[model samples]
Target: MKLLLVEDDRSVATAVSAILTQHGFEVVHARTGGAALQALLSNGVDSFDVILLDVGLPDHDGYEVCGKIRRRTETPVIMVTARSDVRSRIHGLNRGADDYVVKPYNTGELIARIHAVSRRNVPPSGGEVRHESELQFGGVRIELTARRVSVAGTAVHLTRKEFDLLALLAQRPGIVFRREQIISEVWESRWDGAERTLEVHVASLRSKLRASALIEVVRGVGYRLRAPSA
Candidate 1:
């Protein structure tokens, strides 16, 4: 797979690039955020499978770069940073990163994370219905195929995770999805801190949907979607 390595530190980039190359990844090393963005934009649609973005970029913050990348493509981004704090992790995820890894990360673990995020982004295969590509319940409308949501006929913008959480719940309205199930489905991993991240995404979805009555909290169990009354 082709991968973009965005890091200003030459020694670190060289080491990581070597590891990735040994594993058969075609690594494109970019020393600055602008260079990375240029590489991404200049390449064809099938260019890069994943991006390893360092938070300490010389020209731009990783968070800003992540947002810009999201605006341009749905390619998976894994933020590589030394910021191990929960707030920083959440912030990176909120900014559209598929995953976050601290500096001094294990090469094996990093490779696994890269594969996990890429797998999650792949479109489902076979005859399964792409559930609710366009769904309308009461005044809320969801277009999963387009990744768009609207409430009371007004468009509502949501982060990537927020939309995924809502779409999962919307698939089976009124069924209480367990917290663990939600996390496994949405985040695609069983990270210890995933529960907290799930909570944050749920809260963000609720706020963006602006239809509190549509999402019901079942206390300690989990959350469920409430369809509009007929």
Candidate 2:
């Protein structure tokens, strides 16, 4: 797969590019946000499978660049930066990043994230049985194909992770999904720190849906979707 690696630091870029190259990925290194944007624009939107964007860019903020890229294409973006704060992570996701990885990260973890995001973006193969593309429970409507959600005919915007979490629960209403399981399926990682991130995403979903009672917490276990009629 072809990947765009956006970082201003030459040494870091070289190391990451070499590692990704060793893993059989064709890496395109961009040392500035302007250059990265130009590369994408000139090469066409579908040129790259995934993009590893640095938050600290010389020409522009990584978040800003990510927003621009999202506007142009649906390619998955993984934010790579030194900012490990919760606020930073949340902000990056809200701005359209598919994943966030902190600096000094394990090479295995980074590769895993790349594969996870890539897999999620790809369509399913074979003629396997598929779930309904659209799911409706109470006033909530989830359009799986369009990746959209609505409440009482009003559209509700959600971050990628927030939508994934809600859609997973919506698929099997009333089924209690363990925290670890949810994190593993949604974030594609079992990192201990992801537990807190999952909780934050849940809280955000509840707030955005404006139906806190829609999702019930199963204390000490996990969470389940509760139909409004129930």
Candidate 3:
């Protein structure tokens, strides 16, 4: 797999790149945010399979870089930073990163996350779909083809993962979706680390939609969508 390593710390970049190379990943090292963006612009968005971006950069903040990247392409990005707080993690997600990794990360876990996000980048086959073009629950409308969501005619902005999670549950209302199933399908991972991320997205969705009753928690298992009464 080809990867773009966006890190200002040369030592960390060298060590990480070596490890990734040892694991068969072709690494393109970029020391600054502008350099990373230049690489992307010149090499094309599809050139890199994954981007490991450090939050600290000489030219731009990783969050800004992530936003810029999102505006250009749907390429997967994993924020690698020393900011270990929950707020930072959520902020990274809100800015359009596919995943977040703290500094001093476990190599195996990071690699797993890398593979997981890459897997999610692949569009799902139509075989397992609910075959619905759009799903509606009262004022909420989910457009699967357009990947758009709106509430009562006002457009509701959603990150990619948030939309995926909502689409999965909305497709089959009243059916309970287990946490593991949701994570595996939505994040394309069986990693335990993603459970917290899933919860964050759910909470964000509830707050954004302001329709608490639309998604009901099943206590121990998972979440179920409550279709509106006719």
Candidate 4:
């Protein structure tokens, strides 16, 4: 797989690129946000399998780069930066990143996340109500077969996790899905940090749908998708 490493620091980029290359990835090193964008422009949209972007770029912030990438392609993006705060993570996800990995991360875990985001075809099956080929929540349309979503007749791009979360909620509208249940089904993990990731995806979904009330939050409990009215 081709992986793009966008980091201004040459030393860090070199190390990461070398490591990824050793792990059987074709690593492309980009030193700045502009260079990264240029790489994509030169190679076309589907050239790279995954992009590892740094937040503190010399030319443009990573979040800005991520947004630009989303407008062009659905390639998986993993924000790799020193900023580990919850706000920064949320901001990156909101900008359309597939995952967030803080600096000094474990090589094994980084590799795992790279593969996780790259495997976008797999769907999550939890203990929620089973869904058919399509589901509707007012103006939002979900195509489970194709893993596609649209809002008010307009196609909307959703990251892998975002689609999984929405699909889970839409399985049985009006059924309150517990937080643990969501993480287990959508993420297939019992990791403690997954709860926060769930929250970020939910916020992203709500914003993209433009129907704040479509997904009802059961405070101190979980969330449920509102069923269409008669």
**TM-score to true structure, per model:** 0.54, 0.55, 0.54, 0.54
lDDT of 3 by residue, 1-230 (tens): 67899999999999998877655567899998999999999888777778999999988989999999888877789999999999999999999999999989987668668766876774233212245788778999999999999999899999999999998887656545667778887998884878789889999999898787888887765777776672
lDDT of each: 0.79, 0.83, 0.82, 0.81
Q: After superposition, how far is residue 41 of candidate 4 from its true place, in Å?
A: 0.9
Instruction: In model 4, state the lDDT of residue 113.
Output: 82
- Name the lDDT value of residue 228 in candidate 3: 60
Regions more than 4 Å wrong, model 2: 123-230
> What tens-digit string does per-residue lDDT give for candidate 2 at 74-186?
88999999999999999999999999999889886787688668657742232111268988778888899999999999999999989999987776565456676678888
Q: For model 2, state the Cα shift of residue 50 in Å.
A: 0.4
Q: How big is the positional error of residue 92 in model 1, measured in Å on the Cα after superposition?
A: 0.5
Show pairs that collide, candidate 3. none
lDDT of 4 by residue, 93-138 (tens): 9999999999889875787687568656222333224447998878
**Best by the lDDT measure:** 2
- Candidate 1 ranges with C-alpha deviation above 4 Å: 123-230
| Deviation (Å) of 208 in candidate 4 | 51
